[model samples]
Target: MRRFLYAENGAVSVYLILIIVPIFLFQAVLIDFARIKAAEKESESAVQAASRSVMSSFDSDLQKRGLYGMVLSQENSEQLFSEVFAKNLSSGVTANAFHFIDTKAVDGGMRVTPVYALASHAIFEGQLLEDMKLKGPIEFSLEIADKFQKSGVKAPFQMGSQFAKNAAEVEKLIEQREDALDEAWHSTEVMYARITTFHLYYQKRISDLDAMANRIGLHTIDELRIEINQVKDQLQSLSNAIHNMDLSMSSMMTASPQSIQAALSARSNLEQQYSTLSQKLNDLEALVQLIIQYTALIVSTKLEVAVNERDILQLQQSIEPVLRLAKQKNDDIRAKLTAIGGSSTSTTSDSQGVNDVFQHVSLIGDNYFYDYQISVASIASLFTAFHLKIESIALYTAANTNQANAANDAYWTLVNDFYSKKSSIEKARMDANDGTKAKKQTERNKIQAVLDKAKQAIGGCSFIQSQSNDEALYNKLQGDTSNLESANVQGFYQKYRQVNAQDVLIGNDVAYDLDKAESTSLRAMDILGVITQASEMLRDELYVNEYALTKFNYRTYGLEKDRSGQAKLSNELVDPGSHQLANQEAEYLLYGFSSCAANISSAYAEMFSLRLAIRTVENLLDPEKELLNVGSPLLVLLVAAAQGAVEAFADMNALVKGESVELSSKLSAAILKLTYKDYLRLFLMLHSDNTKLMARMQALIELETGKDLTQAAAYIQTNATSEIRLWFIPQMMKLFNGSDLLGCKVVGTQCQFNRTAIVAY
Candidate 1:
């Protein structure tokens, strides 16, 4: 004991043990805390990931099918959540994996919340938490909800050669659509013309028949009897002639040879004269028979093929214009019979955050952002150090492109569905009354039944003459009142009215759905506009870059006047590397621009349609000039009807195939430099000549809206000159029309109009 109390060497060891023991205890507590936190984070992340997966799937299903088949159903909820959870979460702290309990429906979608217990064994002086009587595991409940209103994009345009192939295919599809529409337009015009001709022919025949009827008094016995009596009176007057003829007969028997021959000739002349009088009566009878023939033909063809016309001519004068102006539609039966005419052949978005958003540039866009020196090599060596940056931009642009494509799909799908439904409805409506005979048949059956009963009760109604007016109708109605009362005739008609009201509701739903789908597409225009504008900016950038390279070459080689205004080298010589580098930079920039342009054009057309081009072309035309029924002067209307078919076919190839036989883009690019003024002039001229924009302009010069194409062109020139211009900054073009001026920039450039692009598609 005395030695231990004096042991000073062991004192340092005791203090070291106390310090090391506390440090280890603290370290163990921290490790336990970290493990628990990690488990919690894993649970939360799993919930989020599962929710996102469901939402994406829901949207995909919504687009592919309708709402009914979406995976949001209860049957799929658990399986879907489990799949995502497996991918996103791990059981590092716990022995058990997370499982989905249930999914609850939210406002637009469903909520997926999963619960799991995290088993974390703690170290407390080398003993497990279970042995220590502490909690063995912590339960974690995680919830995530999907938002459907936030529409996401899916279909993205591919890069490189894939883009070109896709664009060609879409272009071919558009051409097929245009050709079909135009062919129908021509056929419709011809059909209308034929109908009109038939109407006129029958109308003239009616006029001739009317004159004959009036002269002969058809449908009247008194006139024919009166004519017969007049002929008898003429016969009575000719009695003296008859007696003379009898005396001639006796003379013929006893006369000399010359006298007898003369008497015989006179007798023959009298016989011929009598025969001519008999022929007049037969002619009047034939005229009456012809009137009956016209009436019978009208009945047989069921008022379709009318003679001295009613049905065909009547429709031609009134509804012909309505039929003419309908948007070109597919007539499967007729189109199919047209020998199934020819077939189909085919043939990104830009990221704004990429630090450049130049819609266009002349000298330089004010918005252009390039590092002056510090990171200048970044853009220069785009393929190397900046490859990831380019890839990122491509990805982001692709997402926006997908959004744009998705937005328009719903609209076009709705439109196609609407038309298909409308066609079906029309067929149903046409058969609503079963050729207008069902009502007549019903009324006839009622009348016949009543007449039978009347005959049984009292007798007499053997004659059945056609009623002339309302008196017969009133009498029949009075007679059938008892039957009508028993049958609830008024109530039966009221049921039809109720049915009609239901149809009206259906109509309202159709219109609302169509408008909603279109609005949805329009909402994404801003996003797509960014992508489109970015694509456009690429072209300008390429031009400027190539232009700059040439200027650099000029200065390096000591040109007399270089645009860059740099001091020329003393010797007219430049290094081979510098020259080669400049050429490479220019070419690469061009390659980039062309690829982006092609991809943007393809995606726009693929997601939506190029039929928009057709609509835009049709819109520019005037109503009166295009439609046969609406022309001002009657003479113009007549002349228009005669040439309606020709007019319909005039600009069809241009509208569909995009320009004339030559590609509009190449031609417009080659020799077509359109200033704003020239653009306006060409637009007016093309639209007026090709469509009906200024059909009556020659006569209506006083109206602001209606003036000669020349005047409109001049005014536009004057205005452009007066305004302060943004020369380098190309303003957004007016879609399909304006894009046409840009030519090859757009997928469908209509060169047929021989006009510049008036708008972007």
Candidate 2:
């Protein structure tokens, strides 16, 4: 040994051997350490590969709907894990002197822990969006949503409930107003009848007074006057003879003195007598003629006075009742207006005018006859006063009747307008033509015209104000009824008539297991959380909705069709044509309704509600309606509903017919332009209940595929634990100073790996 130690050449070899031995050992240990690490990596790789392989075996039914899901039992998962793991591990084998170069997967080593999630969640995460890779549909949906958001359109969910209530109240108020109006008309007619009766009574009294005046002819007075004239003539002749006889007596007295003296005495006496007799006869004739004339005048004047007095009394009585009736009618109309929540202040003024006329007529009692004093000279004045009163009464009667007729005409016109609108609405409802673009435009114009006409008519009514409950409510009824008559409305209902919603959406409730891992799909995302950034959520939701549109069948389109011009089949399943749904998976997903018709119709109505709300706000803000801005909030709501429903109906009809339509007719923007899918996309984004949506989607999936989607295993992430044997763990531990460097738990001669991998597609 000493000699060898002294030998330089041999000693160099020994030294080299000594130095290389530990280094080689260290190298070997290092290699073993690396292999253990490689095994850990290989194990992770195996699990990841297995998870993906399992995911690749997606449910064929879900895939047919463009949804990717996997349904794997634990046994099936373990089997798949082992197969893929072993295959991946067994590839590219290499051998070393220190240990086996390739890893060997342990049988039954992997514990498959699948994290189940609903296909909807996975889809929401943009799986189907990525799969379809269609940019146009998603862009279209986003554009539509952005347009509506910018346009300030919102879903009228709450408005719908309130509007329904308001609509009912409005209908009730309208009926009440109609009843009040009828009562008013009846009262006016009664007043008119009373005025006619009073006028007739006054006319009869005037005719009788005229006849009495004419009949008071002076026949007896004329006969008496003739007799007096004859007596006066005889007296005049006797006075002339007395004068002549006196002259002759004077001549005879000159011829015979004694006879003349006696004749003179006699003549003197005779002259005295003759003069007295002549004066007496003249006085008698004058007195008799004057008495006869005075008697006739007094008799005619008294008769005229009596007749005029009676006529004035009758006229006063007749006019008083008519005026009273008029006053009552005016007061009643005012009261009715007040009861209907109208501004009766104007009617108050009208009542005051009526009261003035009534008071004037009432004060015109038999005081006219008393003022004339029943005298002969006053008879003419009395007759004149009575005639003037008669003329005034006749004028009042004519005026009252004319006014009542005018009022009745106004009420009748309003009622007729309401009925005409109603009739128009009925006709529109009965219309069977399809709503084309031109037709829809025409319908929109008609709606606008109706609204305009209603506004004008309501505005023109004097007795009823715009915000009055009765007038506003009538406007609402007319406007809404007319709007409902649009061609779009007809088209919308016509679509439902062929395929009713109640008939198809029969699965009101679906029953399934609650405890299964797949049952977690029943739990939807927290909508409140998702909507924190509505714009972002909406964009993402649009993608998912677009995916449904592209992949599934709705009322208008089919599901995936094969190259052979037939419905594509996955997993030997027939097309949805044989099912009751008949290709309504997309509709079910959109509206969560089992029926295609229900889905479409609900969406349609929702669109109408939304449009109504938007239109209502628009109308409320309109400058033209500003004059009626007060107390018309309810009216605004109703008007918007009417106009919005009509426009929305037309839009939906046009959309379903594959035409683009604006979201709001009032808004003119390229963004507002939307198509059928765009509308469906909006509905999907607006759908707040994700759980129900998922459930419905799952229901339809189950219905078509006969597989419970809740039971369907869709992998979101996987937790895989596998145990592998490693002979160098102890050595690795010692080398690394008892440190588990691989970040794995080490048992005797073995390593445990719990690998969690996200395996969702």
Q: CA lDDT, every prediction? A: 0.28, 0.46
Consecutive 10-residue window with the lowest summed lDDT within model 2 = 517-526
Name the top lDDT candidate: 2
Predicted candidate 2, C-alpha RMSD: 25.7
Q: After aligning candidate 1 to the native by TM-score, how far in Å is the CA of 23 from where it should be?
A: 67
Q: Compose the digit string of candidate 1's lDDT tens values, residues 1-761.
A: 99888989878889999999888765754443343344344544555556555445532211211111122444465457556654554432243644221111112222242211010001111111122123211110000000101111111111111222322332233334334434433443443445445435434433443454455443444565567567656655555576697786785676688887777787677666666655765665565565466345334422333231333233233333333222222222223223211211111222111101111101111121121111222212221212222222211233533443343233334334433544454455335324323433443344334323322322111111222332222222122233565553322112222322322011001010111222212222222222212222222222222222222221012222223655324221223123322211111111111122222222222112111222211221222332222111112212212222122223322222122221112112232211111112222221122101111111111111121122111000000000011112122221323542332111121111111111100
Candidate 2: residue 80 lDDT (0-100): 78
How many clashes does each candidate structure show, in the order listed? 19, 2
Off by over 4 Å in 1: 1-158, 161-173, 218-761
lDDT for model 1 comes to 0.28
